[model samples]
Target: MWQIFSRFLALGLISFGGPAAHIGYFRKAFVDDLQWLDSKQYASFVALSQFMPGPGSSQVGFAIGYHKGGVLGGLAAFLGFTLPSFLLLFLFAVTSAQWLEISAVQGIIHGLKLLAVVVVADATLSMFTQFCQRKTAKMLMATTAVAIILMPSMLMQIAVLVMAAIIGGILLTRGENITPENPPITLNYSWLALFILCLASSLYFIGQDDTIGQIFAQFFQVGSLVFGGGHVVLPLLEASVGDYITPDRFLTGYALAQAIPGPMFTLATFLGADLWLESPILGAIVATIAIFLPGFLLMLVGLKSWHTISQRPHIAGVLAGVNAAVVGLLFAALYQPVFTSAVIMPLDMALVIIGFSLLKVFKPGIVWLVMGFAATGALLTLI
Candidate 1:
């Protein structure tokens, strides 16, 4: 527990660049350095997290901790990674807005954002090779990527994934067997059933007039429904609470969150603090937990049955499609927000190529990469 907490805490503190960047940082630390999980194991967790709704990067972190320390470890990882952003977002809520406008802070953030660009690119390359090995799988990966770039919406993502599954079922059904890594989760069906029940109950009553209940339901619904990942939270949040939250506040929280670490879903912390004036702290706490609850529960439930379901040939084929689509989805993300957003200038492009080349040659730990890029970015501010 201590190990999980401490490691993730360091990650949370230095972490920036959002979900795609988080995955790169996490893979370097947990899989490459710690040997807590192998690439295949980590990929399984990533696949599942992306497959389901909720915060993509956070859920992946939770699964790693779950793999290491069971339930307690999962919670430990969540707290450790989220604490940095949670506290920072909360502070952003209470403090004057001008604090974030400082030049040094902006320089650091820009550097970290560039670091995210490198990290995400690295992760994308790794996942592409691992997940899209077959010809059909490769084709599906390309198709999915193009489709997403063309239409990057939550509903479109869901449709693409569903179509991928169907294609995999038809084209790639007979393939090699994937050996099981760890045994099934011991949490069992009773807990999973209860989780589903609560999720369903929350959705059923989301229209309630009560303030807290409404808040919980709104977040829970978003957690349950979102398909793409943390970045997709913007539109859903707007639609869910457009009338309640002012455009300025919503945009403010989103903008400030970009400069911080951990999952973008921590936007809930800011939204909660901003929306519920009487109890800002309570709102932050409740909204954070509520938004993340459904996804966590789904991981517990889904991972338990993954072994049994995956063994069948037909199911495995569908998973192949799903995995391919996951890659495509990530590939699309790497371009839009990850690549296009961060790589603006000629220097930015040069930095990314240099970072990638360094990673390929030395294979240094992510800490070195993060620090190096951050320093480089900060220094570039002078020029």
Candidate 2:
């Protein structure tokens, strides 16, 4: 359990490229390296996490923990996987003003937006290969992509996901048997009680005027309420910080978050720093905790009943639909944040094409691509 926790903690600190990249990291570390679970089991866990609310990576971590040490193990896994980014973000939040204002930082941020395009594209393709095997799933993917391109709204995307689940549940219910391959596992209620106690303590601390309290509350709320994964948190976070921070600064931190190699929620660090300019450290801590709270809570709730839930025929169909919808959401994000912000000139367009091609054709390591792009962007900025 300690070993698993340590591994996830290290990955959490360094794993970047959003949820998709995080998934890759989890697969490499836990699936390929550890041989902890088979490919099918890993895929099933991925599917289950996507179907449930909160960050997909966090849930994956929770699943790993559960596999290792039961419910307590799950909590340790969640903490290990999430703490690094949270700490880094908290640090960044404390020093945001100076860190964000650097010209080199601006250039790198611009480059990172382009990287997002490649990451999202690669993720979409990978998911398609893994999940979009059936005709119904293919149709759903195509239809959702079109809807997102034609009418772009987060709400609409969510509605489509819900509708797809309903349709899929109706259609895919025939001749389906729901059974768990693995025997049902027992949960430690004492661990659950401890989790509740921590949550209560977190809530109480949130009301205090100290920097720690403010951050605790804010991040806890973000983590608890956010339903979808990292991408879905954007609008909610945008709303949360809008009253407190400026658009330009927010965009800057957002761009930096893209450039970094970890969870997107690390943007909380940037936001936290911006919010408490005089105390950037406090900001980073707040941001880190706020973004992760939801994933932790959801994982606990989901793990408690994952065996029963996984065995439902309708649940599989709904997950299939949700995965398709996730692809659509990624497509929309590519257009809005990646294309709209970064792909302006012909040179930028060329880079995007090349980046997409590199990902699709060579299937290069994401970390390498990000580094290569960051270097190329730096050179371009100088030129």
Candidate 3:
């Protein structure tokens, strides 16, 4: 437990670049350094995380913790891995926006965005290689990407994923579908009930205006409904919460989240604190907790039966299709706000290319990349 705490805490502080990069960080830490889990086990955890509807990388981390020390270990891992982002978001919430105006801070954010491009590009390639080995799968990946780009929205994302699943079921069921080993076979009725209750309660309470209840309900709904990656939640949250928080602050939080480690879902912490300035800490805690609770609940409930479900050929095909759609989702996100928003200049694109080369060839850990890029950006801004 202590080892998990220390290692994940380290990850939380320096693991920027969002879910994809965070997964790479986790693989390096757990699979390579600690040897806590083998590659296959970690891959299985990632597969389950991606298949579920929660925060992608965070769920993977939670599953790893659950495997390590049962529920308590899972909690420890969540707290440890998430603590840094919690602190950073809380600070961003309380601090003046002028702080972001500082040259160094802007530099840090610029560098981080460049880092995000590299990390996400790597993840897209890696997932394609692993999941889209077949020609049909590859074609589906391209088709999904084109569809999302042509008609991008929250509804479109969900629709594309569903269509991808149907296509997967129809097209991918030809081969043997072996169940992944070490399946979580136990069912907790109370857990599922609680998940349903929380979801229902949040929906029930979404209409309360100018109240914490409304905030909680909105964030909770975003958590419950958004699929694929953390970035996918942007449009949903933007549509739902835009009425309360100004677009600038919201975009700022989003960009800042890209720079920080841990789950991008922690953007809830900043939003909560900013919205309820009278009691910022309470706001931060409630908002953060509300947004993530649904995912954790669903994961805890679903992990118990996912592998058994995966054993069916049709279901496996669906998962395969869903996986392809996920890559498409990430690919679409990388283009819209991520690439479009960040890489505005040739220098920015050049920085990203250099970062990618470093990542592929030198293979430095994320901490160094964050620092090096931050410094480079800061120096350039000063110059």
Candidate 2 — what's its lDDT? 0.68
RMSD of model 2, in Å? 4.8
After aligning candidate 2 to the native by TM-score, how far in Å is the CA of 164 from where it should be?
Answer: 3.2
Which of candidates 1 and 3 reaches a greater lDDT?
A: 3
For residues 1-383, what per-residue lDDT tens digits would candidate 1 score against the true structure?
A: 99999999999998776677789999999999999999988988887786677888999999999999998999999999999999999988877356657666556556666665666567667778877889999999999889878876656766887898899988988855554443443446765796778777776767775578778877887777655465556556755676787655565576557667788899899988876778989989988998888888888877755555555667778877877887787677667655665677898888889988998899876667767866776677787
What is the TM-score of each predicted model, taking all chains together?
A: 0.68, 0.76, 0.82
Worst window of 10 by summed lDDT in candidate 3: 176-185
The lDDT of each candidate is 0.77, 0.68, 0.78
- lDDT score, candidate 3, position 223: 83
- How displaced is residue 100 in candidate 1, in Å? 2.6
lDDT of 2 at 17: 62
Ranking by lDDT: 3, 1, 2
* Candidate 2 TM-score, true structure as reference: 0.76
Model with the higher TM-score, candidate 1 or 2: 2
What C-alpha lDDT, on a 0 to 100 scale, does residue 188 get in candidate 3? 66
Candidate that scores best on lDDT: 3
Better by TM-score, candidate 3 or 2: 3
